[model samples]
Target: MSKKVIHKANTRGHANHGWLDSHHTFSFARYYNPERMNFGLLRVLNDDIVAPGMGFGAHPHDNMEIISIPLSGELAHQDSTGNKKVIKTNDVQIMSAGSGLTHSEFNNSKTDQVNFLQIWVFPKEQDITPRYEQKTFNPADRQNKLQTVVGPEKDAENIWINQDAWFTLGSLKTGFSEDYKLHKTGNGVYAFVLEGEVEIDGEKLSKRDGMGISDTENVSIKASSDAELLLMEIPMR
Candidate 1:
């Protein structure tokens, strides 16, 4: 494994397009800040809140891996590859914009607002065929343990990506603790807390807080209260 490098970034971006409010945890296109460009293979992490009946128009992408995790409310996704679906809380969606693809996302409801997380990762290779997939994950599966949601195998019971990485989600009760082993020897884990509090490798993470740890076989997490979290293991240089 590579040495661990922790990034405790402050909320660094604000972009309001009237209907969409986005917060950038890392620098993104046209919103570049060299120090916040990316971490390892993890490229983008955006917290988005969309107004009712509003969303992104069709946009094009290529050679990138995109993921959407709804925190609350619902999202309607449509792509050129003939995928049209509504994804809600506890649901995960992945789009491999390989070669090229166009898609649009909208808030599916006309009343309540929508909130979600959008993540982007660099692909191992370029120019493959574009694909789209979404799945509803039972929150119960993560009540007291980590539930693997994305890996490198379709037969692994979840979405698969073309990288030596794994994504897990968990919910812990007060005083609960869990340990996670690295999926690959040279990979690392990025722990992102969605709610409540937790301590990882002695570092405290509150809601929306994250930490990256590597060079270890496993890392420990202890919740101070009921908490929801996402752990992503990806290759490091």
Candidate 2:
């Protein structure tokens, strides 16, 4: 039987630091819910909006694979690996804080706010070497179908990560349906609705809602309206 967990949009933890407004899907910083710690190897999922010219200062992290997806505006990133770049909508960025590293992110605009998703996954192995990568994806590719943006390290078509995880994005019209097969036998898929409404495994979800499915080989998804969806398939362990 398939096991499922739902995280309603209203239930997410919120923090407003004047310049930074963030919502957490799992326990983070001051939002500590013992039962909401994580979903498999997916450690953190944060929806962040930064005011013009403001953002996070340098912070240290180790043994974590960090992925950033810009929703609107642009984000400036700098890391200890000597990488510096600006990512805008349709761009994806990944940083492997293997041993240890410090990084900072700031809004690249002075008049517009920047919104993005910050996701962290526990790596399969630790203490390797720090690295950074970024790429822009054509939004047209995801129209009415899934586009793989991040995949296992050996995958040559998309950005590579240090774990057996696959991240896909889709834009669907009402009544459109799709099936996502698990990438690994013991992996789970976390579905997050970015816009409009969707039904996953028969559970209806609206914008910003999240659902985790496990013990299943494949998942069925149908759009209730024009929608945007993100699916993260990661190891259950």
Measured by lDDT, the strongest candidate is 2
Alpha-carbon runs more than 4 Å astray in model 2: none
lDDT of 1 by residue, 73-136 (tens): 9999999999999999989999999999999999999998999999998887799899988888
What ranges in model 1 sit over 4 Å off?
Answer: 1-10
The global C-alpha lDDT for each of the candidates, from Candidate 1 onward, is 0.86, 0.96
Considering only N, C-alpha and C atoms within 3 Å, which residue pairs clash in candidate 2? none
* TM per candidate: 0.94, 0.99
Which residue window of length 10 is worst by lDDT in model 2? 151-160
Cand. 2 Cα-lDDT: 0.96
Best by TM-score: 2
User: What is candidate 2's lDDT per residue for 162-219, written digit by digit as tens?
Assistant: 9999999999999999889888899999999999999999999999999999999999
Query: How does model 2 score by TM-score?
Result: 0.99
